[model samples]
Target: MSNLSGKTAIAGIGATEFSKDSGRSELQLAAESILAALTDAGLTPADVDGLVTYTMEKNPEVEVARALGMGDIKYFGRVNFGGGAPGAVVLQAAMAVATGVADVVVCYRAFNERSGRRFGAGVQDRGTEPSAENAGYAWYTPHGLVTPAQWAAMAGRRYMHDSGATTEALGAVAVAARRHAATNPKAWFYERPITLEDHAESRWIAEPLRLLDCCQESDGAQALVIVSAERARDLPQKPAIIKAAAQGISGSTAMMTAYYGDDIGHLTEMTLVADQLWADAQLTPADIPTAIIYDHFTPYVLMQLESFGFCGRGEAKDFVRDGNVELGGRLPINTHGGQLGEAYIHGMNGVAEGVRQIRGTAVNQVADVQNTVVTGGAGVPTSGLILGADR
Candidate 1:
């Protein structure tokens, strides 16, 4: 639809070993991942002239640039809404490269979520500073609705009530992700598989959300290198073409809470993203052979399928019922294991998986993957990407 579509490509993807504890500073993790990506792309740190990352990212761009000895960075920016920003980082890097803002750009995310401050543990302090942003969180912090799981559970419960979906259906996503992860050495749950019975027996974080339903608290970093498609063709590895990158916020959207909207059971924001991505790429679900939905919670994955038109509303339960998302299924999804099976790198790992699928190098690689859809965080203002192999 525009120059941004198919003009840029993801040339490289890199990540540190995903673990519950990195035992290092977040800055070190960021630098390690960036360097690894540059190496993977057969480039040096000097090749980088632009950088994009998440607003919640602890490592500042300047520090990263200084650490890598990069010169005269032409562009540096950050995306918002936590995990919602991962796909948007690619959008930013692609726009910068396509528009002559920079020649080589890298988008990255790094964190020590498990060893440091755990978002799942809830807000630790309410300082006396009465700020507007803090006040926004204040609205939901009380009444025992603090952490992300609690916030997301509201809509998850409503979806079950409306769609008549069972907890077993939700567990199916975890099962599929784990099944894929079992073969992926990079996955934290590597060689470990779970059954529906295991998911059923797990402890509940919230009423409708089980321990297995939630993504893991992980310490890791992931990075992607983007350059013009013309330049990417000459690089070391096959390029994952940036067919489309879109960010969207539904009218009544809020971070992890959009209960006021008409369809509490559906992800209106992902629907908005799907419309723009389809228009930008001139493709639809029928063209995509694989997908990597953000799995902060299993219920959101189902909603995203409906939002992306992979299935009808309230039909995701049926869609995932019978190995539909596994290796030989119609649409093999989360083949690198999603956040449930792989480490949760705030959705960046999912993007890397999408790129790997395009390059035919994923550990659980699908066959003849012409297009793969990678989604950012749901239950908030979000983003999505359609990465195609260079044609």
Candidate 2:
């Protein structure tokens, strides 16, 4: 077992209301969520000794610490890769707590993605100002593969061709996500469920990719509290144990385009992460009673299931079609709705949902959910976690 496993636990989770327009600054959202999480964990700002957040977050770590009145942060760090950083943030926090670097740590992500700056709109030059990331994008934008949807389209098309998966197969993912979202009161798409027909009828943003297949651009923030398992036992809410956490970046990876790889349809990076997660936790796909796979785009959900060994290669379509992803299914996924139906806070909300499931407090709670798998962004260098209920 990994040294971090079973050492730290998620004591609390908090989030701002999911919405298209938060009507508040991102900094305010971050501060509010952090405070809420601390309150839930039965800890004051003075108790926090570490902080972790995404590099994409506009709020500075010192600024959040200052806003919260946290005393002398002992550890602080940031993970990168857009939505891929959410679970990684929790991992960083868990490491800090488990290693005795900090007694209490907060992991947070907040942004006004839709209302302030849209990430889907292809940019001319994100890294033109002499950053290493700009140098990475230089290879693709010149070829007109700029937008996220367009970049993902290349691999998505290959998956369809190789596996003979139809648009309907992709539609199943969107339908399931929206169905769960429709039931979740906090979901932005609450009471607005979509059917497979709706998915098919939706206009295409990229060929074989419909509007319904895309995740929403949301404005919000989410925060999680990590502390020693012993400390979590005294918190207000039940703790979600950090069974395992891992981040993976495959060789020859690119921003959103890795077309030159040996297999365009495979998610080798996620596969690599999955291998470590199950090993670290001493669990398998069968051990996961539920999952919160990242669904920034629908196709990647299918690929993620396959990469995580939920089913055999090219069998995700059949697995999903057999109702394995719905409520009461073998591996109910995105039960808190997903990026598709829920507001997309760059997958941070997904992590919050995973904690809820482990706590047995999810609106669509699975019975006897002792273990759950939560994944970060797909189609990029991503991360994942295996969360278990605190015994």
Candidate 3:
């Protein structure tokens, strides 16, 4: 079993209201969420000895620590891969706590993606920056695979052709998310649910990809507190144990455009992550009571279900259509409305929602939610986590 499993727990989670525009600096959002999380945990800033966040996050560790009036930090780090780093942040913090390197570690992500730099618009001019990373984009941007939606469209279409999954199958995922979002008071799309028919009628951002199938860009921040399970029990809230957390990158991966693979339709990186997480947690997909599969795009949600062994190859469409992913189904998914219905804070908010399920405080709570499998972005090197109720 993984040494880190069951050693650390999420003591608190906090986020500002999800919105299209926050009208505040990303740094301010990060600071406010961090403070809110600390307050929720009944722990002061002085208790924080470590910090973790996404490399894509605008606010640095020192800045957040200083702003929160936290004392000297003993450990601080950041994970990369765009929206795929949220769960990995928890993993890093859990390791630190388990190793006695820190007592309280905060994982956070904050951005003004909608109001500031819109990632969906795709790359423009980075001014001749010479880097191996930028070079990868050069190969596709020229052919108009500029936006994330476009890059996802290629793989999505190939999956549909290979698996015989229809656009209606993809619409099921959107309908489920919006259904949950309609009941969530904090969701930007609260009280607004979508139907599968609506998903079909929505205009295609990319062929075979409807506007509702793509996640909305939003401005917000989310933060979580990681501490030892022993300390967490003494906190105000019930702890969501970190059963397992992992990040994976398959060979020859090139961001979301790893088309050189034998199968452009497969998400090998997420499969690799799934292998590690199940092994580390000593559990299987059958053990999970609910899921928060990263829904940056609906097609990816299907691919993730397959990669994680929730269903047989090319059977995710049938699996979801059977109502297994809906609330009160076999596996209630994205109980917080997901990035599609909820604001997309680069999957940080998904992690927070996972904690809520474990705490039994979810707006759409699943009965006896003993385990929740939460995934980060797919179509690239990604990360995942298995959070369980304290044993």
Point out the worst 10-residue segment of candidate 1 by lDDT: 122-131
Model 1, runs deviating above 4 Å = 124-128
TM-score of 3: 0.98
Cα lDDT tens digits, model 2, 110-200, are 9888898888887765657777878878877888878888888888999888888889889989988988999999999999998888999
TM-scores, all candidates, are: 0.98, 0.97, 0.98
Superposed model 3: Cα runs more than 4 Å off: none
Per-candidate Cα RMSD to the true structure, in Å, reads 1.0, 1.2, 1.1
**Model 3: per-residue lDDT, tens digit, 83-147?**
88878999999999999999999999998999999999987654457888888788888787888
Question: Which of the two candidates, 1 or 2, achieves a greater TM-score against the reference?
Answer: 1
How many clashes does each candidate structure show, in the order listed?
Answer: 0, 0, 0
List residue ranges in candidate 2 displaced over 4 A. 125-127
Judged by lDDT, which candidate is best?
1
Which lDDT value does model 2 have at 151? 81
The residue pairs found clashing in candidate 2 are: none
> Of models 1 and 3, which has the larger lDDT?
1
